[model samples]
Target: MDLPPLVEPAATLTDAELRRYARHLTVPEIGCTGQLRLKNARMLCVGAGGLGSPALLYLAAAGVGTLGIADDDVVDSSNLQRQVIHGEAALGTPKTRSAAARIADLNPLVRVVEHRERLTAATAQEVLAGYDLVLDGTDNFGTRYLVSDACELAGVPHVWGSILRFDGQYSVFWGAHGPTYRDLYPVPPAPGTVPNCAEAGVLGVLPGLLGTAMAVEAVKLITGVGTTMLGRVATYDALSARWWEISLVPTPGRPAVTELGVGQDEDPGCAVPCPSSAEDAPTVTAPQLAELLAARERGQTDFELLDVREPYEARLAAIPGARLVPLAQLESGEALAGLDPHRRTVLHCKVGARSERALRLLRAHGHADVAHLEGGILAWIAQVNPAQRPY
Candidate 1:
């Protein structure tokens, strides 16, 4: 919806600011008046990874006067594929700092605020306060909920995006003006039910496409130049090269979000099953697993090496002799009917998280002889086979 501009125009633009945004000023839709509104806008971005990378760069280049970056993660080699804001030399550097340096080079007139901490329910409102709008590129559901609730309570409009493998989706949520994130997904998905980018992987250029769309939404919201995606969701399928839209309305009987509580149920890092005792939940190291596999081959032992990762991941790289059973099927009990109850089972995924969930499911269904690989297939690649590539 095109409402009044979110930000009032600054008193006047400096000669350099005028030249820097001349391209924007040339557009009748975003002339000097709109550029000045962008200059007065303050936006907080909840992540400095993936979607945040292009969003931050474009927002800075567009002259959003004040930008706040909230993230506690550092740059890793793996992130360079899509996080374009950070370079090779920035490995191990905090993402907030790395992004700020790049933004300063792109547009010195833009002020970047570094929030070197995670946005929890305790800190969400305080961190989000005074911002004209929020752009959330966070991955985990916990952080997504926190950002949504904080924006709702503060009555701020937020642009949100999610990318997984070949699929991408984005929308705007303004609780006071229209539907919120909870309207699209009323309750958080069960832990381990959804795989993140690390588990599912993504097209390298997909984030740039979706993140730039998010930046456009922010600019439109700030200038009131176009109809914002306040009540509709836009989806993209990279593999098919198709774009679609879905209408969303506030769900009837949905409870109002009056207070924010930081729940651990959706925290990605804490998704592993809680053990009754240390011994009850046993783990096998990569070397131990290799030895056990060798014993099974020699008919000295009997066990099933269950791979709980998606089939695509297995096609990329899989441990020899491991059977494929995607985590979703395992979680839903559909894959259990085919398992051999007599054989001891050792489960694993890309890392240990998904397999731990599968282990818990098996144990809950009366399969007693079960354990997960400690560090999962990644560890096996490092310890058992140096030749294998780590995804």
Candidate 2:
């Protein structure tokens, strides 16, 4: 659908800007009028991670007048593979600062606003209200929902993108005009079921593929020059070298969002607990678990200790004596047959999330006594085995 230019064209473009955007001016669809609109547009990017990296670069080069970068995290060494906006020198710098510095060098005509704090339920609306549109490159579900809801309330259009190991998805979401993100994903996936990039990993160029697409969508939305991806969700499978798109429409009779915090609770990736799930299974602190190990060693107690992380993660580091049982095996049900439900059992994973999932699975199978190690093996390593290396 073609949206009437969301931003009004500026009174005039400087000679430098016109020269810099000379190529855009030649494109019939995005000539001087579209270029002017882009120069007047203000966009807020919700993250400075993989997707944000490319989107920011392209948007700035395209002559967007103002770009707001909102990110509280710092550039990590691991982020270099796909977060191209930052370099090795920016390792300890805040992502917002690193990205802004890069954008400045890319196009000094583009004004950069650094939003150093993470957007919370309290600040999303106020910050988003200032922008004409939002580019949501956030990773976790909690931030995604917050961006969508905040955009809905602020009456701003957002271009959203997601990238995993070999797949990427990008779409434009506007609550007032077409389907919002809630229309695309009505319910958040259960926590721990979907792994983050840190755990699952991703192809180095997947974000680049989708992030540039996100920038194109933003350009379309800003100038109304081409049919925007307002109601269409597109997917790219890099492994197959395939691209596919599916139409998305608002859920009929779905109640309009009246507030934030819609799906925020479903993301266990965040520090907060998942309010949607009641999986408050028993847990033991690392110190308490150490005591249990000693008692078992002294022949005073007996229990089954299970590790539910992936095989690769086990190769990195693992607790001694804990039998390996990846979460996938437990979910498949065959692994349960080997375990005696009557025996006391304990579960642990990389962090507390996966082990919490395993504990729920064990309980569902009639395990009489089961508990998960609190904070998973990382906590155990910190409290019990400081010499152990972390992944």
Top lDDT prediction, candidate number:
1
Which ten-residue region of model 2 has the weakest summed lDDT? 265-274
TM-score: model 1 vs. ground truth: 0.80
lDDT of 2 by residue, 329-352 (tens): 999997999999999999998877
Candidate 1 lDDT by residue in tens digits, 70-177? 999889888999999999989989999999999999999999999999987677888998999999999987788778888888999999999999999999999988
Q: Please give the CA lDDT of all the candidate structures.
A: 0.89, 0.88
| Model 1: CA > 4 A from native | 264-340, 351-353, 356-367, 373-391
How does candidate 2 score on lDDT? Answer: 0.88
The top-ranked prediction according to TM-score is: 2
